[model samples]
Target: MAAGNDTRITEPTAAAGRRGVLLGAASLLAGAALPFRRARAQDAKVNMRISWWGSDDRHQRTLKMIKLWESRNPGATMAAQYGGLIGYQDKLSTEFAGRNAPDVMQIADNRESLIASGRLMLLDPYIASGQLNLADANKSVLETVKVGGKLYSIPWGLAGGCFFFDTKVFADTGVELPGLGWNWDDFAAAARKISKAAPKGMYGSADIWAPAGTRAFYPFEFFLRGRGKTAFTEAGKLNFGANELTEWLSFWDGLRREGAVPPAEVTALENGYETSPIIAGRSAMYPINSSIASSLQGLSKNKLVVGTIPSGLGSKALPATQYGAFINTSMQVYVNAATKFPKQSIEFVNMITNDPEFAKIQLMSRGVSLSSKMAALVTPDIAPIEQSMVQMVQYVQEHATPLYVPWPKAGSQIQDLMQRTHQQVAFGQASVAQAVTRFIDEAGQIME
Candidate 1:
């Protein structure tokens, strides 16, 4: 999409600023506002701003969870601002610039810019002070949220990447279910077979816009590892060249041109399962994050099954870490650097991440719950949905390739380059080699 046409739906930051100004005016005119007077006299009540981006269902559940926290703690009140996925980062950036950022904000997976801007509160002091306990949180998830050797945020849940397939379609096509060890050649052959057997309206696969950070780049990185290379070197320099990238791009271009997958035009317009060719039964397979599987359930009239990404040709099939569902490199809640009530804010964040009841409400909203106890509670409510996600997670834990260190600064931009490169190549605007070279050049500029 064009940058100008990007619709930014922020929750009235200007209005919030106006409210703050008006409150100051009222306080000056009347000597003190009633709430301000109460706040000053009482045991220092903390009113915190909490913000995140999600759909309406997520908002409702989060609000309910916050209400429960409020009921338990009478002295604290949290004001919330929520938006959809598309414009969240832009809105958050605006709020941060205005110094009107929430006391607690959900940082995205690729949030190096936010970290670099020093907008987030470091949680190390809180953790070291014994005010926050992260003993139960996954170590990998914790590592992802850490920057400059200090924990800046805590993951709300785990997310994994996997391919969603129509089980019946595969069965009817006489294609065996994909196993953890299946290689790319196996996948290609299956796609061809499935394409032949698929009905007129259905194709073998739907192409997703390559993810811009851990979500998109990590999976392909995993694939590259099987070919004996990494995207970047130990010193965080681009290690692979145009030749390798051209091969990867060529694979997907071939798929598109061969009619195994829909064209980029069809895929680009689809933002989610409701509009996704796979969920609409126009394709037999789609690779997506596990969190979205729940949303896909209702959208798909057929039985949807989760599977691993295919391994490289001839190499030992390395199980790629289920990129989306694992807790590492996930969305996190961080305290604001300027909050007056840091302790209460941390408690509130703890309430959302550590509290079982509240965490249950966050089920599949962020991904699967990170807390095992909360996962137990939420899974029972959404048994079938949760089961599929759990199976994928377990498969990755047992069978996937070894996990790598989380990417550092400029990680997000690198992924963005990859996605745009894929689009350029898939649309035939550039050859695979040209696309790869362009990506490297653009990524280098961002890294510098």
Candidate 2:
């Protein structure tokens, strides 16, 4: 009943894990109470608690990896806790507050505060002492997780933002399938054409401000970078001005008015691929990170093709400018600072990240591995959808500018503000100028 404790001490079978995850999701939505257990240090034993939020596939593979780890290392025991992504932050935050956080947990894109707040174990010691291996990891990729000269986490999967188009829909609309050379103008025109041709109850595209689709701020950030503007500087400062954001919002507005994208009301219904117009055959395209490629494909029977994020004028004009897709560390593993078994935790992290055997089990379910060796290990068995994702990431690395810097401490708050104002502007609750002005003022206050 604890944050990390299950009905049984060992890992749950796949079926049991699925049931637990469903129950966890239900409890989260209903706001029902869950019993929290305090950490208990068993004397002379390496019993450690680990937790993560993932799909059933990830959960099952991770459980097998845990069992393998225990088998390989005698006198060790790992109690596992896993669930879906909804309400994960609140649950983890509660554990941290109660000083009962897991030894190892999965960290997603928004862990700047967790690192800055000193709630994560500084991983440098483990790396230096060779308890955690990173000799084959990409150094540049490794640098992305550093905070204040200390590494608090390691990437679990590497992916990039991409445009996923249903080939059949594009063909049906008589629009060219998007590829590397596609630009914003082409995108807009294609969206309009697709919307006109789509079956009833469908639109050209989903609103880019979709909260449950790609990260709400991604399209805005991509636009900024395409224009050679910084959304946020390396120092965690706001990089673009109100005028630029206004232009970005105005672009979306044009799409809405021209019927090139769904209206605010339609977009409001679902932010993810499951119910998205694109997946449901109402739209021609969906924009999301490469990691969601298979999810999109699984939900639809259409032949989906991976496409580049639509480019801006600067990328075409300069040819060498920092504008293109976002090649980013999409998922990461973080150790709880309060863990009693740091060595055991580091070992688990190392095995999952670099072990060739473990890599085979994981395949590309977590996106392409950042380590070249692990990627090679998993490449042969990779599914077609996953292969597309890997190729997409590789393409972004070769073509685009570096991804945006980690958000400042107030990054998540700023993102939420942008999502709210974007909706207001799209729905006519506020004008473009008014929304931009309000956002700049409030965001400036938060950054200050």
Candidate 3:
């Protein structure tokens, strides 16, 4: 249980962590023929600046991990720089654009843009020197982060979109909890049933497609992928047209009309996890990024359990896997392309990802470990909630379609447009047809 603690992340033996890092991977930096400028000498002191955006929990744990790293290797310090996610992207964008980004960073939504900016470093050299061994990484996931046959980022872990439900609410309502392979039809029916039988103030589900259009789009992408197509292609085109988009918007509209989801007023307040309807006990189930379930569970009084996200189970000749959710947030952790200490930066990330004791400290807070070794290391005694996350990660890693395309700048604009368009439909401000047309047309404009 000590190693499995999620909230109070106690550092395991500092020596064990250090030893694992020192001896875990073979080979040293073979040469200095890399980077825009000269690489640091092998024995030179390394003081790295690592930045990431997360809640207090992530910030504190990352600091502790940094301390452990410093303690493991004397005189090599890491200065911490982090904040809430609100403007982190813009700040990082400004930093990267200025070529003053941190040595090590955890990138997410802005990954494609940053990578495309010709500022991020390719990790092929480190991998070639065996300083960063990816033999343990999930092959499908590693492929997603590669751009033009070169690596820039390493996933913190792997996760996907999934449904985390309050088992107590289902039990009290006498509605059966869904097993694996549940489809959208099954999801809506159970939701309507739960809404009808539940207490006066509560609904069956949160408006998963809430204020953020991209929030809605995650599951929509999964839903589309289940039908053997994707929302966007590698060429940056809207792969699904009005007919498909209308169906997606209208499905949510029907749920809102049936009161199966919380009203718009309630959903608008759900911009942060602390304000989630599940945490507030106003809803029974939510479609969430699978990795956050443990953190969210810590906030809830209910026995929360995760299940596969609703997919196109009714579709004949489904893809290799019926599960529609693909990996999310594994597109994290990168070395600034211009870092003078490329070797040190790669070592730090390599340790955080592949080290055994570090795996125990980190657990699946980011995502399930994509490394075969790290995955095996943490799963032995992870917290029950974390175990559920691992199971979901495993399910998606095995069955869900592999989804990664370096998004252009227009991607964010399109996602923001989705938020407004979805809100219009949810608030009864726009017809599904109108909203769909606007979204498609605006997305087209954004692309052009």
Winning candidate number (TM-score):
3
Residues 289-309, candidate 1: write the lDDT tens digits.
666666676577778876766
RMSD of 1: 12.8
List clashing residue pairs in candidate 2.
Answer: 2-37, 212-271
Q: Candidate 3 on 98-214: residue-level lDDT in tens?
A: 778899987656576777777787888888889998888888878766776688887876777778889999999999988766778878888899999999868898886644212
Could you give the candidate ranking by lDDT, starting with the highest? 3, 2, 1
lDDT of all the models against the reference? 0.69, 0.76, 0.77
lDDT of 3 at 132: 90
Query: What's model 2's overall lDDT?
Result: 0.76
Clash count list over all predictions: 8, 2, 3
lDDT of 3 at 54: 66
Q: Which stretches of candidate 3 lie over 4 Å from their true place?
A: 1-44, 211-214, 315-323, 402-404
> Candidate 1, which ten residues in sequence have the lowest lDDT sum?
317-326
TM-score per prediction, in order, is: 0.81, 0.84, 0.85
**Model 2 worst lDDT window (10 residues):** 33-42
Candidate number that wins on TM-score, 1 or 2: 2
The residue-by-residue lDDT of candidate 2 on 1-448, one tens digit each, is 6745753544566668889999999889776433322223226688888888766667787888888888988999999988866678778888887888889998653588778778899999888888988998877667655776578888887766677888888887788886666678778878888888877666777778766666567767777777676578878889988777877788888899888888888878774456777776667777776666655677778888777777775333223245545665567888988788887888888887898888988776667887889998888887777877787777666666645466788887888888898898889999999999999899989888
User: Which of the two candidates, 1 or 2, achieves a greater lDDT against the reference?
Assistant: 2
TM-score of 2: 0.84
